[model samples]
Target: MMHAVVVFETLWGNTEQLAREVAAGLGLESTDVVDAVSAPAMLEDDVDLLVVGGPTHAFSMSTDKTREAAQQQGAENIPRRGIREWIASLASPGRDIRVATFDTRVTSPRLPGSAAKKAMKRLVALGFRPAAKPHTFGVHGYSGPVADGELERARRWGEELAATR
Candidate 1:
């Protein structure tokens, strides 16, 4: 049985729901879907796989301070504020970890896949392989009902990831 940890940050709860579905798909008798902010300290060490996500803020993952700075700068493209900065702060340093990522955002149909690209780059730099494209669950402005197919897609993504290892 594979041990997996799925953690996420959400302002409007859409992303958290997605994380839970990911855990369900893994079908682990022991699994955790936790809020990134209050996550336990040793959450990362023993998992066979790590899934992390948040809403896209400023074309990347959300950081509490960056959202404030963007709000002050009048930037319209910031993602909601959360623990993405904490993710960047982690010092994996040559560790071997398999990771996948996802995000929740309104479908731009115009940004042309920019956020996923940025997320893949960040994940690789943090010593994780880009296992899958970063997914974006939809929202009507900010609070979301999640687009029609988004949850199903997420569930399918989880199954696929589980099958990979």
Candidate 2:
């Protein structure tokens, strides 16, 4: 049996909703959505997959400056460390872990660069193999309810991810 950890950094809850849906689609027993504020330094030994997510900021992963901008925009609950920092903080797992990454971005004429893609690169550098392609779920704006039918898409994506494992 495969067990997964779904962790995310959500400024406006869009990523949170997506993360829950994805975990549900993976047939996970519960939506153990770990926010960046509460993420641990390492994955559990029994975990088979690690699903990481966050909102894209300034065409890539959120930095301290971007997090500060989010806070300045009345985001009272913004975390001090984003996924980038979390990835950097992770120590070697002492075992191989399959990894997947997703990002939430606004739908625009020219989309911002994906945090998911960058996160995958970092994870690969740390020596984890990817279990799925980097994914992006679109938001309407900075603070979003997510696009129409995105939750279903996320669930389907999760299913696909599980099939690969």
Candidate 3:
């Protein structure tokens, strides 16, 4: 079985919840789910998969500025660091490690860009192979009780990713 790490950055907890569900579907015994602030900067030798996720901000991943804006909007427990900074800090893996990316976005008024897409590109540049196409889960609003069935959908996506390994 593949060993996987799921790292997520969230403002309203929706992305973090999806990350947990995804990790659960990946088989909890083989997966480790962590918040971006606590995620490792380098992949362990035993890790075969790296899954990353964050909430979309300004059409892509959150920056310090965006995070501050979110805080101003009543978001609490916001991470000091976001996926962008965490990804920037990652050391290139010594071997090919499969990677997948996901994001949580508002359900209404379809977005123009994706944090997952940006994250996937960055991971690829750092020598990780794409395990699957980027995915997006929906939320009712910035601070959301995620969209009705998005959690289940995210788990299904994780299951599909596990099958690829």
Which candidate leads in TM-score? Answer: 3
Ranking by TM-score: 3, 2, 1
TM-score, predicted candidate 2 vs. hidden true structure = 0.93
Clashing pairs in 1: 56-79, 57-79, 58-78, 58-79
Which structure among the candidates has the greatest lDDT? 3
Query: For every model shown, what is its TM-score relative to the native structure?
Result: 0.78, 0.93, 0.97
Better of 1 and 3 by lDDT: 3
Candidate-wise lDDT, in order: 0.68, 0.86, 0.92
Whose TM-score is higher: candidate 1's or candidate 3's?
3
What is residue 107's positional error in candidate 3, in angstroms? 0.7
Q: How many backbone clashes does candidate 1 have?
A: 4
lDDT of 1 by residue, 1-165 (tens): 677878777766777788888778877766778776665545456667778877776666666674666457554544433555546555553666677888877765434343445655776887776566666667555556777887788888888888885
Off by over 4 Å in 3: none
**lDDT, candidate 2, residue 104?**
95
Sort the candidates on lDDT, descending order. Answer: 3, 2, 1
Tell me the tens digit of each residue's lDDT in model 3 across 1-165.
Answer: 578999999888899999999998886467888999999898889999999999999999999999999999999978989999999999999798999999999999887889999999999999999999999999997899899999999888888888886
